[model samples]
Target: MEQAFSGRRVLVVDDNADAAELVGEVMSLHGHDVVVAHGGKAALAAAATFLPDVVFLDIGMPDMDGYEVACALRRDPSFDTARIVALTAWGDLASRARAVACGFDGHLVKPAMLDSLINEAALAR
Candidate 1:
């Protein structure tokens, strides 16, 4: 999984600064170019420059939910092939349904296991 993700561009968005930094650190260790965005607005700004191949977005952000972020990214032609994965605390049936409806390519239940996100994205690639 690490080898597959290495050299790839990734974006990690979370309202919690610590969580985002932790994810960024983990991805960086595996040689992925990672950008950490603290909110949906910052995520969009980063996307403009970073053009990430994969995005891990937190669903419970106070400013902008992951669903909204995914919707916005999907509307952009540039992100048509980007893997937008929702990171949520909940992993119930309803949550999965909502994620599917929101244009996310995958879903990671939080404390998001990097393995799941990476493996799913790699397979898609």
Candidate 2:
């Protein structure tokens, strides 16, 4: 049987307020501590204080794209164990490759399945 996972601190970043909130709500429902940021800058600020175990980032934000945010997080030793995932509308091959190059541990297309989100959080454990 599969083992059960405990709650984790999750950060969701997106330019769309609704999208960020929706993801945050879903994660919270699954027993994760969730924080929603409306842009990359906000995400960085939140990460500094929240120290999330998992972060879901949107690639197309106007100010500081997801790649930049991921790179910044990766540079910080405090975030070495954090799981950063790309959660964006851009699911093309090049985009996926870029995500890896920028330090994303996983990639999920926008409107990702709820189960997938929960599973990603669980994997951070």
- Each model's C-alpha lDDT? 0.83, 0.91
What is the C-alpha lDDT profile of model 1 across 9-119, one tens digit per residue? 889999999988988887787787899999998999899899999898888888888888888888999998898888778788998898889888787888767777657
Q: Which regions of candidate 1 are displaced past 4 Å?
A: none
Clashing pairs in 2: none
Please provide TM-scores, in order, for all candidate models, with all chains considered together.
Answer: 0.90, 0.94
RMSD values, in order shown = 1.8, 2.0
**Residue 63 alpha-carbon offset, candidate 1, angstroms:** 0.9
lDDT, residue 6, model 1:
71
Candidate with maximal lDDT: 2
Q: Model 2, range 1-125, lDDT digits (tens) per residue?
A: 23255578899999999999999998887778899999999999999999999999999999999999999999999899999989999999999999999899999998899888878888852
Clashes of each: 0, 0
